[model samples]
Target: MTKTSAVFPQPAPGSKPTPRVYTDEQKSMIEELRQYALSLLLPETDSYHPNERRWIEEPECPARYMRAAKWKLDDGKRRIKGTIEWRREYKPDLISAEHVKIENDSGKILLNGFDYDGRPIITMRVGRQNTQPSERQILHLIFCLERAIDYMPEGQDSMLILVDYKSATLKSNPSISTALKVLHILQDHYVERLGRAIVTNLPMLLNFFFKGIGPFLDPVTREKMKFNPNLHELIPDEHLEVDFGGKFDYEFDPDSYWEQICRHAGVNADGSRFEPEWKRTQMPQQEQEESPKPVDSETSSTAPDLVADDDDVESSRAPSVQLPRASKPVSVKGGSSGKEGVEVIGEEEPNVLVASA
Candidate 1:
């Protein structure tokens, strides 16, 4: 009896699954949602609470806010026009001992109160703190507050003048030296575009005061206020002189300058400069004379013959070969002569050979 052996099938090894691909419509929808989410939920803005006094994050936040605010303001109107009003209020002194308040059974009173009332009175004090407004926040607050006041008509002229004066003072003040240094640091360390935008927009903030809000100021006061001449220009011309040492003087022929710089650095601007002049240094006089000739097949074939003729002439002039003696006897009848001799033989007709020998 013959028995068949059992056969087993092997399982296939697992392969990696392919990533799912989204359709164009799905991708477009996803991008749209991402943009909307980014606009609405800016992480930088979300980090700061509304009540916080710091405005350093305003550079990213105010732009988004202004866009929305402006859209809302101009939705129904053809040209929305308005004016802004600003004013400076003296902060209450908080550092003096007299500024401190004590609460009594009848009322709250300053320690140095001239007259004390029996009614409840709250004391409010203000003073300079270690923390100051960020430059970005200061500009944002100025812009937003100006916009807010512009939307409203009350005290428009007065506020415009005040904002301009305040901005000018800030621009000229030495107190913000640290902030300016920080701005420079930011420019160096952060994305260059962002730093440049921030620096550039600082002037725009001033321009906004002078141009956008300046019109509302009283004619006499407007004449008194002067802006830095450079403030209005976005990018200065090459010939223009900026108050700072920085100037724009770009080379018209940068390639020429590059060549000169490379030369000064002890580097060849082009490879040909370092290459030996073969015509002047390495080439023989004969080679230089013959270098320009074109070598076709006829010329190339004749070149070997010319070289061989030169070699033959040189060999003939050499003292190595012994010449045959002219006085030697000659034999012409197919007979040998018993002396050193030369012989000549006549040609004969050719004979055919048989295949079988």
Candidate 2:
């Protein structure tokens, strides 16, 4: 099937980026939220809730909450207070690699790459999921979400989510309950943090999956969802994965990638936090020339017979679904040191294959 391109007007080259100008009323609401946050008495111990106070007092965080509450001071205060209490229970910041290592075994969720707007990208490959539906899976997701939020640089408040359903069938889709839980967490605590969500290679059968979670999604979150758009326009070729028709050919290595994530989080094997070297280490580097030519959106084409087979021994038993045929064939490569490779088969189906490094 031909992929349709979604055109977002790109800012003119070298144009001065617009700055956020808030009105006086909004400013007052933000200040009120900040004051409310400051008045709370959190535990002095940082281990259980590291950076708790600082996060509440973060200059941009209160504004984000206020905007999420539609600038209503009371509503925003309730949201802020609720989130503070929820963090104490959820401990998203304290979720460690050891706590969710098993969930990472299949490399299902990854925090890598950036979008054209420089928002950090979190790619979730549902077909690669190895575990049954459980609360641990949610913890794993919260861990990755925290890491993504921490990776955000100044001036960037949102993240880009790429949910790839390449080898996914109806059986592999997340349960409605789990989906609703995810929706609640994202829409509530992580308010206004989704820059955009691009759901690619989605199977028709999985349309019901979205329909199941549709009602719980905030209208704004629903609007951020994009389906099978030309990803090249949204992500730079260097950062885009080859699995999604870009130059970055990243294979998933569960072991090494997990270590990379742990090191970034500065957590010990037992789930305790430690001071990392703070070196310039990053997610697996993209191995390409200093500057690679970007793919021309107008001239780009995909393999007509390109297909991803559910070759995972664990997920092989789950039946696959027939997928729309593409225009060009993509060569799949396996990774070294526990990196799982993608095996492209005939034009049978496109399942959940995450294109992340």
Candidate 3:
């Protein structure tokens, strides 16, 4: 197994440095989970190729699953299993930014420059944008996470996410279930990926979502979370988006980003609209990024399409989280399968899954 520094210097100059590397026992568990997860995620279809099989073995990939599992084989196994199920259902790698692109959502969730640690700066305008349905929004977020992960080099395996809260309201706040799931995925699946989560211009109504979210955060991530009333403190000017008090005028361009993602995912855009090309690298390609195009009037994914009734859904057998749209006290709906009722549990924290249905 390889090692990289995933922790950052604390805001307190005298604070002790934290542990970021996986221990030997954890490493062993990671290897085990990797072997098992590979079996689950890799389909014996015609699409399977020798080089394609190498993705799960990428240096940091397995280790991430272990850390999310907190070094427990059982936990790691479940995380991998659940991820495999989600992957099949959402088919994330096949999902191109072009296919889910919202012209207006470009700024709502834009990646501008690199941070001091050299991680990409991803600033999301939660107050202004609603790009996709809760589930698709989560999927798009996963896509962004994929891009962020692909581009990061070994030592700098993270990104700085600034959730802009300028004009936030209760209605605008994403459903608690989706927010929890997204945060859970980030902490668990990505491992040491959030360098800083600067939440600027917070609204009072947004407090409930944050409160429910408090229990799920990783210690390191929780420590890194800050309410930056002013973005100038944590985010550098070059990496900061103009709307969020930074110099850069960043916008999300599906075409450009999709091209980059295609190359990263080893795919291409041909006569088929989106073609899977084997030439893409699993990691970030060292290329110059051009300025993204301007955003438009497109609407984001609505809650009805993705936000699920999480209250009735237990957190134990959560093979797949039902992402129904945002509403108060969700109505009774069919279980995950709609026929055979599967007991679902959301043991999502620091990104670990306890079991699968």
Q: Pick the candidate with the highest TM-score.
A: 2
Q: Candidate 2's C-alpha lDDT?
A: 0.58
Model number with the top lDDT: 2
Instruction: Encode model 3's per-residue lDDT on 120-185: one tens digit a residue.
Output: 666676665544343445555666666565546445556767667777555556666666667666
Tens-digit lDDT string for candidate 1 (1-357) = 111111101101111112324456544443443343234332444322221112212222222222223333232121111100011011000011111110011111101100000111111111101112333222212222222221221111111111111222232322323323323222221111110010111233333322333333332222323222232121212111122212322222323322222222112311111212322343455321111122222223321111000001222121111111212222111100000010111111111000000
In candidate 3, stretches whose alpha carbon ends up further than 4 angstroms from where it belongs are 1-29, 39-43, 46-52, 103-106, 130-135, 216-221, 229-234, 242-246, 249-305, 308-357
Q: Cα RMSD to native, each candidate?
A: 50.3, 16.1, 15.3
Residue 199 lDDT in candidate 2:
74
Model 2: worst 10 consecutive residues (lDDT sum): 336-345
lDDT of each: 0.20, 0.58, 0.47
Judged by TM-score relative to the true structure, which candidate is superior, 1 or 3? 3
Estimate, for each residue in 1-357, the C-alpha lDDT of model 2 and write its tens digit.
222211111111221212456899889878888988878747564443335765776668998888778788898899988888776655566554565677777767877666656577788887876766555566667777877776565566677788888887655666666566667678788887777677777778766666656677665666666667667666665456668876556666666566555554455444445444432232344342121121121222320111122221222122211222222222212222000111122222222212221
Worst 10 residues of 1 by lDDT: 334-343
